[model samples]
Target: MVAIIKTGHSIRAMLNYNENKIKQGKAECIGQGNFPVDADRLTYIMKLNRLEKQCKLNENVKRNTVHISLNFDPSEASLPKEKLLEIAGSYMEKIGFGDQPYLIYKHNDAGHPHIHITTINVQENGKRIVMHNIGKDKSEPARKEIEQAFNLVKAEHQKKKEFKPEPVSVRVQYGKTETKNAIENGLNFVVNNYKFTSLPELNAVLKLYNIEADKGNENSRVAKHSGLLYHALNGKGTRVGVPIKASRFHDKPTLKKLEKKFVANEIKRQTDKSRIKNAIDNVLLRNNIIILPQLVKQLKKEGIDTVLRQNAKGLVYGATFVDHKTKSVFNGSGIGKEYSAKELRDKCGANLEKLKGEFQKAYSRDDLLNMIKEDRGLLSIDDITKIVDLLSKTESTFDYLNKDFLKQRRRKRHRRGN
Candidate 1:
């Protein structure tokens, strides 16, 4: 079991969040604590008023509301609702919020089975419960005890297990699922899990699952208002359906929310920069002469997706890398100059120059062509093209020494004499 505790200022906001989930059929209010009526019989206003009344006792407590989610492993998904409520009650008591007016919501949105608990730290006597380091001081010990008592999978054990993002299992195939649900699921997976700083970087990750976040053109009303929309992309990457407004989603992933995330991810993705840089450097190091396509193939093998940005003239001007292993996205220039598109092209060009020098010093044009023809399997098309280019640079010398050129010249002389 893993317990995450969050504190905010609005109890109504937290209640409404869970209530909205219930209305969407993604969650249900299954249990309550310190309430006069049973959990099922309690109305939305009843739940809100009960918590609000205690909150009103301490007007000084700004951060009075507490929202906790007790997440269980997938193996324990079959655990009955009564058992889940029991676990929530115990967890709250251990964390010192058991006696407070709270509601337990069984959320069916995520892959694992988890329940959300909404409560307040403020008590009836206008005194606030101590909320300092509550997770480390109280919740940690509580989680371990609950794990052992319920014979549930340990959080440490679950940590050792590899986490596959939910989006990997299913992609948004147009016309298959509701557009809103598809976009929501894709956004939930990427927005919460991936560390992306810019909108383009975020799109690099989103495009993998056939979803895109757009703010319209610069001159458009949506862009002028800083509004954003998410659209489903067809297999060819064209927008296929009506765009869903960002605000329409539950988490409200609006432009403002994403801008905040951009700032936070900028700081979060710094430690991960070296991982991507090293991956690119290692690929270049191993293959002394590699083009962009080969470099992309090698990085994909290392669990990184390289997205090359090109202009209308087909010139690659930018590069973005998505590292699946780390769940981090980085622009090439963000990592360093050498990883940028221009610098990368220069590096590949430099390798070709080196190969040209080696071939010039080692073999003549005819000898190089003979070598290539004799060992065609050993060379890539790029290698053969490079050799052909070298031959072209010395075409006069090649013709002077060629048997085919001599035969053609002699035949032309004979025809003229005739």
Candidate 2:
């Protein structure tokens, strides 16, 4: 089972979306709670709205509406309706919203059966349930428990079979083309699925599908002025068309929205630190692994993005891994000394400079042999001498590349010549 949560300002919009599905004969009301009157669509929305107005909360509390969906694997089709409801209720209880008034709608509009949940996040006392790291901190653990108790397929296993959003399909916004719809869906997918620490790390996953949440420059008028601009990006990081204000996006993935996510993701990803360490171990265990880019490309398939932190002189000083699956950021040192940025060159048996650009990662012995076919064949005695020179320079990669020292030397040489 997989759970996705969204908090918004309006309960009416969510109630209507599910109610409209019922009107279309595509969905049916399964269960509801905390309504003053009968739990029909009308009373449901009225009671929730009355409660929100009664609380008299300010607009700053953006999570007044809680919209979530629980998706089940197609293989679990034979599960009884009673167990499904139990699971839903159990999940809600574990996620810290069980006591709150909520409505459940099971939709058969798609090939597989799934359910939508709607509830106001504000309590009777007018306090909002904390939304920070709700997904990783709460949902993931609850999901594992539910999956075990219900005997369902694991989500991690399902992820391998799922198709991620494509770049071109997600970026185009012509003539009410699914651009708007796609962005909303894609944002939900990325937020719920990938564990990202910071905005740029999150954007790396978002931009893959041509979507970006640009906060503008720190000194720029947009940042000084305050607000977020979400725009479509091309295959390049450039904007494809007009940008949408953060407020304009339905889910409102504003800086505040994402900051909450980042903090949550940081905590959530820690539980899966071992998973990342295992991935690094798997790649390094390969006998022919020879470059950083090759390892980086392979790690992407595992839903891990490797960021090589470099200085102004183009020397790598650190490495951070954005584990999208876990939604965590880890420094190379944080994981282990062996996996640190400085350790990678020695670990891969490649000089730092030679590892730049692109390199082919070898998966098999034959593949490894084929990769070096373009190389100058096997190394002779002369090649050995050159290899030693590279290794000596590789140990102190910053040599002759320090900008300050290089500038001083140039000035000194000019004065002496004059």
RMSD of each: 9.3, 14.2
lDDT against the true structure, each candidate: 0.79, 0.68
Error of 2 at 27 (Å): 7.5
**Per-residue CA lDDT of candidate 2, range 1-418, in tens?**
8788877767667776677678768788777666555445445547557646734664557657888888877776676767877888898899988878777788765434578888877776767788889999999999999999888888876753243443546336633535655565567667767777777767766766678888887987656645677677665456767666666555667777678878887777778789889998888676343555567767888988876655544456667787766666677777889888878745554532343222222233343334344222222233334344544444354443569977999999999999
Q: Which residue pairs show collisions in model 1?
A: none
If scored against the real structure, what TM-score would every candidate get? 0.72, 0.57
Q: Give residue 254's lDDT in candidate 2 (0 to 100).
A: 73
Off by over 4 Å in 1: 6-13, 58-65, 127-137, 159-165, 168-178, 216-227, 348-418
- The model with the greatest TM-score is 1
